[model samples]
Target: MKTMRIWFGCSMGLAVSMIFGWSYGFFAALLPMFVLVQADRWSTPLHVQLVLEIVWVTVQVSLLVGFFQPYPLLMTTAVAIMMLFKCVAMQHKSTYLFGFTGLLIGSILLNFASYNFFDIEEFSINLWMCGLATAPITALAYFLFPEPECATPQPVTVNNEVTKDEYGMVRQAAMGWTVAMIAYLVFNLVI
Candidate 1:
């Protein structure tokens, strides 16, 4: 029920971003859409969802990065990494954090390699911008779907009452998002 509204908001944001030439915005929105679709009670099977997610993401990336002379192998690897991270992130606790960390490491390696191998300055900047955009988009999505524990309070009382584990995790993730955004900004300024 509530998921639909979140998905719509994400979709609309992505559309607006694309229209305004912010490719990263479109990719950022996909995170929420994938989350919303995964949360759907009547959602399609896992295989179907994976197929659609991959196809749509691939299409989006191809269109967004089409202007650049992307290296085929690197592009493939990047998309593969994104798909894997998205799949894992759609699951239970700590998945997003782990998946994103992996994606970031892979991207840093790839982008650094691209810069050295191809002498392209824009790839690093684009990667940083992607991180900046992803931080907010992910934080917003987490705020909307949130973990069940954080989103609801248990009636059971423990010294009055203690919130669920999801609350702690979600709060930590929210805080991390701010750090990530700040780090991205600082790095962008420095680099």
Candidate 2:
């Protein structure tokens, strides 16, 4: 049942994205899949919140890139700090929404800014559209593949709890941030 929901949600998102010819449509696909798999309950307000999260991270990256364009050292330092915070927050599961948005979506926007692409605004708009569409795709998935009533429902997110896996979580976050840094370097060097 979970697998079916994921497949249906992702396929629907991808189909809509493809139909619209959105270059950043993979975002649309990915968000719905994640929501379907992770969240037991999703609401209309969640969609709005997700969109706002994307926009907020977009603004943060844009500001960082805009102000620090001339100073590689300053830009890198600031971004690195921000990403480190995001990584830690994500690992801690404290403010998962912000951490997830800031780490993943923010990094994408930062990469785009680094590339100095002429059509970046277009791409950002496409990304925003994808975010907006994610809620519906997830909602539709729920409608089409409702969970069996016999199964206990999980909350949307787990409360932050102390676990023995701190080292593993930190390692994962470090790995993620390292990849983001490498991608940033490649974009800067390539452009």
Candidate 3:
């Protein structure tokens, strides 16, 4: 059942993207599919997902306009600040805040490197459309296929100290930053 939901969500995303246009269909599909999967795993609320998507778009635009064009130093500083915020947010167990934002940043950086930073309007349109499409699909999937009951409730632990999970989040942030840095360097070198 879970697998089916995942498949359906991905398919819906792809279909919507294809309807929008073939050139960016795959990339458009990826964001929705990723959000759907993560929402399932984390049990994130719809409102939260919506907010995250908005933030993701805002960040993408900021990077493209404010930093990616004429200010390398500002871009570097912005990336660093974002990475630090992601790490801290994760350590505080704010997964939803960091998860989508981190992914958005990394994806944008990597894609920018590969495709150059032209066509910002097209990219933004695709991303916003995909994000809007995700909401309905995600809501439908959750409503139609609710999570199954578990046999036993897992024990919950509260610890002030950093745990393995927190460490993993930090590592993820670091890796994302590293990838962004490499992408920026390659982009500069190539262009």
TM-score of each: 0.32, 0.81, 0.68
Q: Pick the candidate with the highest lDDT.
A: 2
TM-score of 2: 0.81
lDDT of 1 by residue, 1-191 (tens): 45644665476557656765653454446444544444433233432433343344434443424543256555554445454544346334434433453344333433333333442234334334443444355445555655454456657755854445776656655554444444433443454
* Cα lDDT listed for each candidate: 0.45, 0.78, 0.59
**True lDDT of residue 155, candidate 1:** 77
Where does the lowest 10-residue lDDT sum fall in candidate 1?
40-49
Q: Each candidate: RMSD to true structure?
A: 15.0, 4.0, 4.4
**How much does candidate 1 score in TM-score?**
0.32
lDDT of 2 by residue, 1-191 (tens): 67888999889999999999998899888888756756666666546656887887777777887798799999989888888887776765335665777788877777767654446567678878998888888888888888778566766887786685767987988997888788877877787
Model 3 residue 147 distance off true place after TM-score fit, in angstroms: 2.6
Quality of model 1 by C-alpha lDDT: 0.45
Q: What's the lDDT for residue 98 in model 2?
A: 58
The top-ranked prediction according to TM-score is 2
Residue 119's lDDT in candidate 2: 60
